[model samples]
Target: MTSNFQAKIEGLQYDALQIRRNVWRALHGAGSGHMGGSSSAADLLAALYFHYLRQRPDEPEWPGRDRFVLSKGHANAALGAALARAGFIDDSVLDQFYAYQSSFGMHPDIKMPGVEMSTGGLGHGLSVGLGMALGARMQNLDFRTCVMLGDGELQEGSNWEGAMAAAHLRLSNLTAILDYNKVQQSGRVGEMLALEPMADKWLSFGWAVREIDGHDMGAIVEALDALPFAPDKPSMIIAHTVKGKGVGFAEDSYLWHNNLVTDEVYERALNELGAPE
Candidate 1:
């Protein structure tokens, strides 16, 4: 990679680490929150906010800005961290996670500056993102729409319907990223409802599909840079990640999916994450 490209990757990596650290910070302050999903998504979220998505953090309501919907809204801690880091919201908001009447709750809220959609009801964001993409096309705008999905939520039939519709309409501006960490709240996704043949399923539905390591900054950047893999189809990126990625004890365990983050747990997690440059 060129020096410039290498610098970019390093910068994103630092941002991802900070995002992970702040995710723990927010969850610990909340007393209990979804850590597994939030940690799993940190790298991808960092890439999106810092490298891929196009938007004016100061002018969040800009009509031409690209749209992103977090379908797996339970990972709001990570999203909040990204938004704060990107200057779309105050950093203090991270401390308000799950606070009574706070916008920074367990899920994304449209009321938040950088949040495109208020989502938590799994299987809905893809459809909403489809509409956004369609609207952009109808309005003759160059903006794109991306939706981040959770593997556990794919069991809902609504996502498939949106997938089929976007493909049929040839919404090439739409992209759906799956944070396929394999584990869910109660147990493994494979044990719950397998989504094997995952890539083939999307390809069969007419989407241009690509799979990559979600935690790999280089791979994540390359995938986002190659959006709408096909000119005539929506794109789907299956980003394989690890649940509770940074912390050893929590990694890959469902117990950390939405567990208590005691002071000790928070310290350990930050230690594992290390300090951001």
Candidate 2:
């Protein structure tokens, strides 16, 4: 049953590699930008942008399109790559990342064509997504709202507030994806403040929960497909991921949290990620 999903996951990895490359490529263009969170989100972002999110690349403001919130706005590089890959923006736009007067920055901005919310505040996306879902319900629109959250951000108590409220509203239109990469800026989440029993906490809060290897494309897609796992609750997909998922030098560590780019490091990162056949 899961084999087919695995095949899709393999494809998603390829897509993710492309995204990881683009992330560095974009940062290289900017000459400076976020990479740790962005790299960690590459695979999932590829799956969402290329396979799941019902979006209109040619129509960024399509009224019927599903919405995605990059709550961990530091991962905007991956989001930007996905958006470019999905055709919402010119691929070259990434080349201008962080350029003066450029829309791309360390965080996401709603002014950008493909960005739904301007988020960088650790624990805000889920709450905003709840509002978007609730609005969809009130408007009688079938569009769903998905929020991509950071594990470090979960330390904020306000996320629990949104979790509580989403379930209270029974917002099946909503889905919160926790990018559980273990490490945050300073160190490992476990060492900082453990978020163990993660799935249980969501379930206890009235959210229908699913756990998946965040870097596995198939698991991600299936988890997304399994949305609204309960008719009476919001859904939470907890993605266990590596801090810097693709690059060997960067994975699972806090040192790369906000790194400076150099020509040698850039080449090494690209080589580590490897070129696709």
> In order, what lDDT does every prediction score?
0.95, 0.88
In model 2, the worst 10-residue window by lDDT is 1-10
Assess candidate 1 and give its lDDT. 0.95
Root-mean-square deviation of every model:
0.7, 1.6
What tens digits encode model 2's per-residue C-alpha lDDT throughout 106-155?
A: 78889889899999888999999999999999999999999999999999
Off by over 4 Å in 2: 1-7
Evaluated with lDDT, which candidate comes out highest? 1
Model 1: lDDT of residue 74: 96
Look at candidate 2 and give me any clashing residue pairs: 9-218
Clashing pairs in 1: none
Question: Which residue window of length 10 is worst by lDDT in model 1?
Answer: 268-277
